[model samples]
Target: MLVFGHCFTKGNYTIDAALKGLCTEEEEELERTMMAYWANFARTGSPNGAGLTEWPRYGAEEEYMGLGVKRQMANG
Candidate 1:
């Protein structure tokens, strides 16, 4: 199922709340986009299979994509 969560981020980035001083228009956009993609995946079990950019599945790699337009890790 397609889903988005604070997950390891905990209550910092939830569906109804975001980190204090961090919740802004930019965050709203991200949440909206996540919701859209999440719904699509939930319904189809595939995200952007065609006519869309391929979103890679997560791996054990320490680095992952982030807000800075580059891959970064939690400690970065």
Candidate 2:
């Protein structure tokens, strides 16, 4: 279902005034999964699945996805 990347991200990008670009493949995979989930949400108001939590629109005080800053890194 529609899930927020925060549900899978458990690391901080910075600590102690230090800017450490900590990125992991596992995190990237999680991000991808979350993005796909959102695609389903966009097409339909609800995500199709069993036992999945209901996804609500942001600003609605309900159990749903929450968004944080999304940034991209360049390797080329």
Candidate 3:
């Protein structure tokens, strides 16, 4: 399953500011990106969305997107 946990996203602390902290442009952009991903995933089976990085296929690499203040891809 996709891990949107504290270790993945900005962290649990940000939850407290979820209602008020999206004031910055970057924060708003990230939120919009996340919402789009979720919406597309709900409509289709894939989480792909416009302007989002290509989600790598599950394989031996074990790669995933570590979404946070700095969104990036990681392998474990």
Candidate 4:
């Protein structure tokens, strides 16, 4: 249930932890989605991609992606 530092950890940790049942299915899904976003952003300038949730640019709305068991867009 600890999401802190997950993005900085190795990808194998996510897969291994999921395979070992150390993480919930929801957590795994969120990690995978995050990984995809990161990879896409590294390849391109933006994180937006097909099949993934839209990551809106930061603006006056102060919107941001709320990463958790249930990932969603949240307004600050």
Best by TM-score: 4
Worst 10 residues of 3 by lDDT: 1-10
RMSD of 3: 7.5
Arranged by lDDT, best first: 4, 3, 1, 2
- Residue 69, candidate 3: C-alpha displacement in angstroms: 3.3
**Which pairs, if any, clash in model 1?**
none
Per-candidate TM equals: 0.40, 0.34, 0.64, 0.70
Give the runs in model 4 whose Cα sits over 4 Å from its true position: 3-19
Instruction: Give me the runs in candidate 3 sitting further than 4 Å from their true place.
Output: 1-22
What C-alpha RMSD separates each model from the true structure?
8.8, 13.3, 7.5, 4.7
**C-alpha-based local distance difference test score of model 2:** 0.45
Instruction: Please identify model 2 stretches exceeding 4 Å from their true place.
Output: 1-21, 48-76
lDDT of each residue in 1-76, candidate 2, tens digit only? 2233543434553341232234355555556655766676688755533433344444534344442233322221
The residue-by-residue lDDT of candidate 1 on 1-76, one tens digit each, is 1133332244545543444344555455555556555777898885444433455555665444353212234422
Q: In order, how many clashes per candidate? A: 0, 0, 0, 0
Error of 4 at 14 (Å): 13
Please name the candidate that would achieve the greatest lDDT relative to the true structure.
4
**TM-score of the candidate numbered 1?**
0.40
Which whole-number lDDT from 0 to 100 does residue 27 have in model 4?
A: 72
Off-target runs (Cα >4 Å) in candidate 1 are 1-22, 49-53, 57-76
User: Can you write out model 4's per-residue Cα lDDT over 1-76, one digit (the tens) per residue?
Assistant: 4463354455657544544535666776777888888989999978989888889899999999987777689898
lDDT accuracy of residue 10 in candidate 1: 44
